[model samples]
Target: MMLSCKEATRLMSMQMDRELSMGERLQLALHLTACAGCRNFRKQIGFLRTVTRKFGDQIDDS
Candidate 1:
């Protein structure tokens, strides 16, 4: 069955966090490369991670 955007988004997050199984990760990777919207979503998720990691350090110090 085809995954919905929300399902794909959740799987993307899990993949980013290394929480997905190898099989699951492979599936998500395939889907992301094929789906432009999901690919953009993945990019946004990556950008968010970078921003959070950068700012999170300062937040912890305060």
Candidate 2:
């Protein structure tokens, strides 16, 4: 079954912290292929990760 946008997004975030099972990975990949919004969300998450790593303390918490 194809994943809903919400489920795909949840999986994308979870992927940042841990590895997904093969099934989850497949689901996420399929969802991203079909959903442009989710693809953008995934790209944004990746960009945020890069920025955070580069500017850890520079980004104010508050």
Task: Residues 1-62, candidate 2: write the lDDT tens digits.
Answer: 89999999999999999999999999899888899999999999999999988996687978
Highest lDDT against the true fold, candidate: 2
What are the RMSDs of all candidates, in order? 2.9, 3.4
- Candidate 1, residues 1-62, lDDT tens digits: the string is 56677888999887776778887777777777679999999899899989988995677644
Once model 1 is optimally superposed onto the true structure by TM-score, how far is the C-alpha of residue 42 displaced, in angstroms?
0.6
TM-score for candidate 1, residues paired by index: 0.70
Give me the displacement of residue 49 in model 1, in angstroms. Answer: 1.1
What is the RMSD, in Å, between candidate 2 and the native fold over all Cα? 3.4
lDDT per model, in order? 0.82, 0.94
Clashes of each: 0, 0
Model 1 Cα shift for residue 13 (angstroms): 1.0
